[model samples]
Target: MDEHESGAAASGASGRLARYVVAATLVRSADGGAVVAIVLLAHASGQPDWASGLLGASITAPHLLGPFIARRLDTARDGRKIIAASALIHGTFLGVAGLMLPVTWAVVPALLLILSGMFGPMLTGGVSSRLPSIVGRSQKSQRRAQSWDVASYGISGTLGPAAVAWIAATSSPLVATLALATAAIAGAGAVLALPRQSPLHDPGTVPSPAHTLGSIWRFGPLRRTLGLTVIVAFSVAVLPIYAVAVAPSLGDAALAGTLVAGYGVGSLTGSAVLMAWPLRGDSDKLTSVLAAVVAAALLLVIATPNFTTALLAFGAAGIANSLFFAATLAARSEYAPLETRGQVFIWVGALKIAAGSAGTAVAGTLISGASWLPVAIVAALSAAAATVCLIQRSKGRT
Candidate 1:
């Protein structure tokens, strides 16, 4: 390629990455806030605490099929459009739920949320799996992009809950729900401005779901990456618990949202630090170390004497979680075969989301026992999973 062509290509990639980051944050913030908005709405409506978690679960549980849906996108001419459409559809459900939650049966909104969640992949893995094509083939460029992408989740995580909580505190839960839902529509518009692209398949060369799963199982390091992904995500479900059980008992209910936002703020801080001085190592190995760090930080939260200390602990854990996420993403990409790569991202991401849902359900039940019980169990499980991943790494799995 000519020097001119290389320059133009780099410029284009830079531009695309910028737009992708902005749009992703908008979409993710809406999706992330859905948990808080729904929980608060349910609680405000006088539903049981378990019902609040179940409602969040309703939207997230459908993430199980994301990997297969990813294959469908792999065959599509342009996935961004589909992803944008998904955001719009999901936002619509949240909006409708907001409007109807006051007068309609809770079941009606629950059903809407379930359908909305079926499209959840677009929010997480769908856009992420496309980073390679967007950022070009350079490993450095891709790593940088991954940090930026993870940072979006961090920003969204902090913004989503804080936004909803502020609005709920000042206005009402219904208004917060509607406001958050608009992010999806805005994200759809941002996605359409990007360049057109071909499908991942060559018309008829798509792999089967079984083939994709086989690839993941065959790679020891990749399998470990996925396992740690689940454990981290499950522990992260403490978001709702902070809102419903822990923070409120300590003080105001708004503190629950504030605590959740602290984690996100920590995520943002960690990702920023990584981006400035990017890590260089076996990503698979990095993942295990980061996972252990995350678990340790969570345990620290349990020992904090008060809300201020708990927030700091949560932020520390958030930073660790963001770093772990980047390592896992890199490991999965490096270890998985190219053909099934898209499926791998969505599949792993689906499990991550599903695990979080399971955590919410379990946390709700355990909240009645002791507020610290859920955090304790989650931290222990994450620590165990991190150790297992490290052992596999030592076995020369990478």
Candidate 2:
């Protein structure tokens, strides 16, 4: 082909890749928004603290199941089909459950928890596995893909709560749930548009799911990456509860909402900053220090008695979280084998879910006793653990 024709073809391919990346990102954004809406709906329905706990549990409990399911399904006849099917089923079920049941019904919360948990790994693993296919195998390409995913989530985190507030105010909280369901449907559509099987997975070679996951665990780099993810999750767990704690003190629910919005704003800023100028360094060292910084920020929130200080602290925490997420994912992808990328990614998702659940549950119980010190202590410990893990990994590498 002539030079012009070749250039035109290359440009066309780039455009297609960009579209896929954008679509994947939008899907994730909608999912994040939907999750926030579900939590808000549970609260609005006057579910007791136990019920709310269950709602949170339900959303996260899926992480435990993620590794097992991804292991089995990753070797299935069609990984993409499995992902698309899961998304469609999750969306439909969630929508119907939200529409039919009142907030007080225990069944609704249970169903939401189950659906969300099941959907979490399927969606996350599917997306991460597919990334290498849409973008090239180069580090730069992978970083771009990861950045797109993080950026979408950052935007969703900001908009999701606002959308929930607006919908909950004007109409029923069910409206918000329905909106999330719509996003799930769109996400499924995006998955369907993808090639039948991810190029990351070889059609000719099938490894035992157990072996696949086991290999990921054996890889020092992946293990360190997962360890950092756990710490990130623990630090993040503080944000939701912190927002709730600060709400009553502000004398307005809207202020609490604004606090979260501020965090979202900071998250967006952080992600943008990362994308504009990505981090390049020793992944283990970089992630450990970032986790420590985030932990320190959380401590500031706990130490400060004033609402203004708390707000600033929370905003800074959000920015730290955004950077940590981008950096962590980039590190994970780099260390993972392409064939088993989905399994590794799912494992990270599972670790994060477990950590967040544990952190939130513990933090909630502690804060109930009117003490924020315990919250800070837990965050500090988690960050410390993450740092130690990374340091050890660095040492081993040397």
Give TM per candidate. Answer: 0.86, 0.84
Q: TM-score winner among the candidates?
A: 1
In candidate 1, what are the lDDT values of residues 124-179, reduced to their tens digit?
87777767767766678878888988888778877888899999999998889999
Tell me the tens digit of each residue's lDDT in model 2 across 143-256: 766766677667655565567678878997789878867777787877767655544345446455578666766777666667778767875786777678767776765677
* Residue pairs of candidate 1 with colliding backbone atoms: none
Instruction: Write down the lDDT of every candidate, Cα atoms only.
Output: 0.81, 0.69
CA lDDT of 343 in candidate 2? 73
lDDT of 1 at 77: 75
Q: RMSD, model 2, all Cα superposed? A: 3.5
Residue 156's lDDT in candidate 2: 57
Q: Largest lDDT belongs to which candidate? A: 1
